[model samples]
Target: LGLALDKPLVAVETLAALAYNLYDTEGLVCPIMDARRRQVYTGIYRFAGHRLETVSGQEAIGMDELLGKLEGLDGPVTFLGDGVPIFRRQIEETFCQPFSFAPPHLGRQRAGAVGALGMQYYKEGKIQTAAEHRPEYLRVSQAERERAERERRAQEGQG
Candidate 1:
């Protein structure tokens, strides 16, 4: 751990790292992780002179909604991540712009990609102490949603 090593920690955003997997590719890079319930953890990105630029920030969003946002963007989009296999059919049926899936070998999350991006962040002075790091979940967990629903039902019954 960075704390034990006395080194600053460089946190790389998941979606950004996923998009980095396609660093050599051209056009837009869309990394979509299956978030279930017809939604995905995704973001739109593009490379500008070896620097990865975020066209859209990461978020947990519906597949349809994500597609809608991509619809307006120009150029062919390269899709990757676990969500591709799950939503391939829907994307084929609904998406009008040109697109292609990353080959299986490069489709999923890779540690190399994360490390590479982490290094980029580190060089850019984005390092932080381990205690200052935090995970960005993008949305509440399913268990939390279920607990809230149960609480609401109990309140309704008591009322």
Candidate 2:
């Protein structure tokens, strides 16, 4: 709807879900979503001048691997997303640097955030056509995962 009206559409993957919630912070914004099997879908980002910059390629990685990347970083880091609660204690203990989780209100994605990012893109002359727009959804649903697990178990039993 916003695009039909001739507005710039900022790709959510460009800014990330957590980037929209972080306002005052100037440190790295690491958003991690649980991807199961001790792996997470994560992206590292930080604001450089007027724009948010990606510090690392987003990937589904194990906790130890993610910690290794974070170990190289200094200063404060804001950790958020559904993955945090799952591995909070491990993150606190394994991370040698100072870190904090976003507050409850700013922990998740919201519609207002998408709109705000869209406006910023408009001002920056980052407009896109409706035809060019495509949803950037990734990850399989829990139901699908469960079904796959059941199939795998049945196959194992047959063997």
- lDDT (10s digit) by residue, model 2, range 1-159: 755686545565633646767854778888888888898888888877756667886777898898889889876788888888998999988888778898767767877766776676677777777768886545667899899999999999999
TM-score of 1: 0.90
Note each model's CA RMSD in angstroms.
1.8, 4.5
TM-score against native, each model: 0.90, 0.73
Q: Which candidate has the top score in TM-score?
A: 1
Runs of candidate 1 exceeding 4 Å displacement: 151-159
**lDDT (10s digit) by residue, model 1, range 121-155:** 88889999988889888999889999999999999
